[model samples]
Target: MAQTVSFMAVGRFEVREQTAANAGVHMTSTSPHREPIRVGVVGLSASGGWAATAHVPALAGLDGYELRALSASSAESARAAGEKYAVPLAFASAEELARSEEVDLVVVTVKVPHHLELIRPALEAGKMVFSEWPLGADLAQAEELADLAHRRGVLTAVGLQARSAPPLRYLRDLVAEGYVGRVLSTSMLGSGWIGGATYDDNYAYVLDITSGATLLSIPFGHSVDALTMVLGEFRAVSALIENLRPEVTNITSGEVAAKSAEDQIAVTGVLESGAVAAMHFRGGTSRATAFHWEINGTEGDLVVKADRAQWWYGGTQLYGARGEEGALTELPVPARYQRSLKQWTERSADPACSVAHEYALLRDQITGGLAPDTHGVPDFRHAVRLHGLLDRIRGAARVGRKVTLTEQGS
Candidate 1:
């Protein structure tokens, strides 16, 4: 019989341990022999946010995981979200959710600035934690959280969900399977859609570099993460980061805001496999190409294009040409690449698609079905490494020189 823990937020908070039948909590599990991993989401709001848009739908569509609890900024909001999402429990803060025995996994979906505070409690409680991208506001915070998670021996996952995307996974396999036969060079150009000449009042924080949610860290960070996954880590890199748009108009209130976050980022690096890599990311949508990437090799070439830089969302198309081929032809990602999420292919444009895939990988990881080291899910340690790389990029840009990974303590 599966054990189900129940919680009642009566004025304060109370926990009661019981079976599903006795607690009157309906347990939904895809596997009859195994219980679902109960998940508590921090920052789930009734008004709708990334957590509502992505994580709610993701957990809803997947098995072996249940959206059990949620925490909002206030008790009223938490209760509202609980009722809206049909979650069994709700809390006013992340610490309450983290300390709950009912929640086997605590997912931190808040902003970058609050990531350290939200994640620290979960790690301290020895609960499995899944934090969104960037991991922290900067390298120091990420390193600190990673160190704490390590000390706690907790299972951790970061929201580098592009690694779980079907197309990206297929692309990685193709490159590994010698589809492009010893890649000689790769180039990518993208538009971040933020840090542009216009901004939304709600997203004004992105214009501040101190927020750590800049164009370079959000869009470029996600895109580059996928790039490194397909290819390999950078052995050395030279970068140029510039703030082309110093002022941006607020689309909502028509007020002008001074922007410090960079609008342009250029990076050139050597991959661990000795392949040359170059990437250029600019703010705002482009009339010509929003996103384009090409990999050239001795025997063949592959190209990936999307309607926008955020390939993880949708419109990611793959094309390739080899040896005697006269033209590049579209290469459809095979069904096998979708794994258990083949049903979600049609909904690839939805933000929940890749998130669902990531949740599935996390489920596998937690259920002992997937080895921690072998699974493609980026953990806290991986986040720390990526954060360090971003630091190196900033350092290189500041010094106007090339930075070697080994010399920079990679």
Candidate 2:
């Protein structure tokens, strides 16, 4: 037996209430048991976007989850998406989708600026939520959403999918298993593909620093999250943030615009384990090297490289050398690490591969198969801490000084 929940439109928002008992309706995972987590996605357009390119395929390829509903910017678009994706339900607004009793999880894959508005309603409706990274436009907004989720006592997840990548997972275990014994230092250099001299209309918004979708927040943010995942959190950091290219050309329209976002970000810090760390990220792709990271230890060293800065998506390769070895050799990810992802091996570059892995972990957690504390499954609280760390990096750059992080991540 289950109780049906109804929602009434109150101005711009929806208010939810228990209406009556429903004999056939299935309850959410909040009931402590549910065969499949029904997911309703916000911003899943029929015209194609990140949701179409990644989330849709990821859900389709996974088990214990169903893409039950979707919400686009308009009713027509929603209907188009529902028909296009063969989803059962469609809504014109995110709030409406969030209030639907048929949806157990609300996945918000909208833009960074709209995250707070879209995610708040789902949290208020007491539904599980999964939002893409940069959980909010800024640190304060992320903290606010995290606080509200905490108060509501709901399960929430943030899209830091790099942590779930098989190669990265194997890399983490190698370090933990003493492959790189007594790590001494590590360094990473990457190119911020979008922050370069050329831009498209779709990405023009990121050129404005106030939009909160800058190079530092998206590419650097994602890459650093994976870095911290493998090497632990930073203890203290000093940074130099600069805008080397103030003007960028629009590739499509041939128009020039002033780019306020920083193109050069260099950070030097010490990890919690006392390992020295240095990372430098620059705008535009490098003809020589797009992504390269190395870990040096007393016993050996490890190296990771990719064609692009975004290693989470794919093309990431791991290499290592130890003892008297004069050269580095490729280290294949263990079969066990990629057991569930065998089907995605041929299409490793597809964004859906890593996303599918993340969804699998999420399913395991919801179904009581995996512990909530499992690594790589980041929640809203973790997003807040990462946001705080980003804030500290900005503060350190602004003051030209070193900032130390505390246990509480202030």
Candidate 3:
């Protein structure tokens, strides 16, 4: 049997704590009329491509959700995703899926360059949306989306779910409970081997930015999201972006592939809580890698390793790892390639009932007019923040200066 731990439902956060007698007692029964959420998924490539992958699977396993529809750029792919993922609805066009009155929310899993096209329509339609990170290819688009969402009061969200992991949540709770006392500095070593050629010509807009999924968005972007989750938001940052591998080929196939996007990014910034967060992203390596971070406070220390970096909501454990620390201590996050496997199994649930957790909050926002505790879902505004940060990094490098930022959501 799985080990049970004490937990508290603080806002949307399921943080662990030792104080209260009634922690993790399943207070969900008290909140009714907050019925199951209806959901649609678009893009279905990589993470999206593997719609049957983690996202769908996680939603499928959760108690209150539905998987109403699946969308892809091509009719065949959309059909394939629906058939493979076991969704009743499938559409080739994003607009068709986004406009589903039956769908309370949509999950955008398309490429970074396609984010704007995929996002604006859903927001304008007055629907809640959740998309993969790096909200935009750059800041201007991100800002435009954020501004629009804020103006319309649309419920939007992003995929920085690492904040929901047990260990990280535990760490955050510990810090709040005085385990780490007053935090001083935090350093994250996020390294991996996403070094390969990209076949981005299929998507034209990103010629100036990047090619493969490994470099810019997945590795660096997710790292930033996770670090921010662990250390808090940014107070300006100085970044050094690098394209280490001028020529690289896909590991799966032995052929020359075009390379454009950044291979490495180093950033150091202050958290909104005034703690420091420093991180480095390096790509193109001989082997796979892991992530690790530490928080130093006035009291003791809180640390987490990649093996402990698992994201879950309900029963979904997307990607797992057991490290040198032993099975008990190490978490079993879904393996990277295995993401789509779980999503495929999620077909057993009603598509309309498989909405993600973020959308649950979003549905609440729309219907009940309540505020979300952590509205970090990948909406238009977050796109703006991410893009703005990217620009700051580029500008800092050009001027050889550090960019100072005010507190986030300020």
The best candidate by lDDT is 2
lDDT for each residue of candidate 1 in 1-410, tens digit (9 for 90 to 100): 55654432211112121233321111111112267788999999999989999999888988888899999999999999999999999999998998898888889988888999999998988787889998999999999998997677566788888888888888888998998899999999998888788998778889899999988888989988889888888999999999988999999889998999999999999998899999999898789988999999998999999887677676588999998998999999898767688779788878888899888876664554543233346878778878888889999999999999973344
Off by over 4 Å in 3: 1-35, 45-48, 196-216, 270-276, 285-289, 307-379, 408-410
Better of 2 and 3 by lDDT: 2
Q: Per-residue lDDT tens digits of candidate 2, residues 35-94?
A: 678999999999899999999999998877889999999999999999999999999999
Estimate the lDDT of model 2.
0.83
**Clashing pairs in model 1, backbone N/Cα/C closer than 3 A:** none
Sliding window of 10 residues with minimal summed lDDT for model 2: 22-31
lDDT of each candidate versus the true structure: 0.82, 0.83, 0.56
Candidate 1 global TM-score = 0.90
TM-score of each: 0.90, 0.91, 0.71
Q: Would you list the clashing residue pairs of candidate 2?
A: none
Query: How many clashes (backbone atoms < 3 Å, residues ≥3 apart in a chain or on different chains) does model 2 have?
Result: 0
Residue 388 lDDT in candidate 3? 60
